[model samples]
Target chain A: EPEVTQTPSHQVTQMGQEVILRCVPISNHLYFYWYRQILGQKVEFLVSFYNNEISEKSEIFDDQFSVERPDGSNFTLKIRSTKLEDSAMYFCASSSDSVTEAFFGQGTRLTVV
Target chain B: GIQVEQSPPDLILQEGANSTLRCNFSDSVNNLQWFHQNPWGQLINLFYIPSGTKQNGRLSATTVATERYSLLYISSSQTTDSGVYFCAVHTGGGNKLTFGTGTQLKVEL
Candidate 1:
């Protein structure tokens, strides 16, 4: 099975620093999504991208957050200024289409100090 | 906004027992998925049944789109099956998923 791959399984950064989470979605998949899970909380959707543009985003994806395909293979999420509340497990998921099963990566544990 | 609710927030069972997890949606949806979050926090896709029934080994799932609910059945549960089960739904007209808190299952030997 082709799985989504994430870089830096765990990330630790200063509170005011910037952090970029990288994901390489399944080669053939077209849609991409970013979700986050706070410890002991439900998974929350951050943003969804298709055709190189954001299809939708949650309130959590505010001015500080941005996502880009960058190229044909990489999907990246960057947080301009990190905060203590930003610490969470960020997950990357991809699907061939909306109706199909979305595959997820192991996740990047983002920790802000 | 669509609401996803999962029942029996926590459950404990013996290794050889059977368990059923339920998920209910507030409105009609176009996509539904079941996932297992292991101890290592790896999210594993278990099923994507928007409607009808499907089975894979000791696991089976059924979704009734019209009724807006889904069920995940784990038979002959094992210690390895202990994890958090999540149900997420994609409401019609939106690509984002709304997830329930999830059911935490513990299978003991």
Candidate 2:
């Protein structure tokens, strides 16, 4: 079955550094999203992208975060100046439409020191 | 914003036992999904039952949209079924999913 794939299964970055997490959604999927889960916490939505632009974002998705479908196939989430609290598992998901079931990637474990 | 609450918070079952997990949403939803988070932390999609009933193998799910609650039933469970089950919902015109607290299950011999 076709699946969403994320790059760098794990990443460790220093405080104040920048990190980019990349994802390749299913070939025909159009809506893309970024979500994060802190250890032992529930998953929280960060942002949703459609038509090559962000459709909606949560309060947690502040100035430090940005998402882009830099290419036709790749969607990326960039965090500027990472903080210790930013450490979490980042998941990328995509769906064929807004109300369809979205598929998630394996996720990237971001660790900030 | 909508609120999601999952029941029992945690469960333990013996191999071959059966169990039920529940998810309750505060408002109407356009979509509802059940995901199993494995030990490796991958979210495995189990079902997308916004309403009605759907069964796949030993697992089945039923969502009563009007009641605003969904139930996931696991029959003859196995050790591999040990993990956290999360129910997420899509509300209004938003594309982002609001996830439930999750039900952690541990099936043992």
What DockQ does each listed candidate score? 0.83, 0.96
lDDT of 1 by residue, B1-109 (tens): 9889998899999999999999999999888999999998889999988899999999999999899899999999999999999999988787887888799999999
Top-scoring candidate (lDDT)? 2
What fraction of native interface contacts does model 1 preserve? 0.82
Per-residue CA lDDT of candidate 2, range A9-81, in tens? Answer: 9999999999999999999998999999999999999999999899999999999999999889999999999
User: All candidates' lDDT scores?
Assistant: 0.94, 0.97
Residue B62, model 1: Cα distance from true site in angstroms: 1.0
True contacts kept of each: 0.82, 0.95
What is candidate 2's CA lDDT for residue A77?
Answer: 99
- Residue A104 lDDT in model 2? 99
- Quick one: best TM-score, which candidate? 2
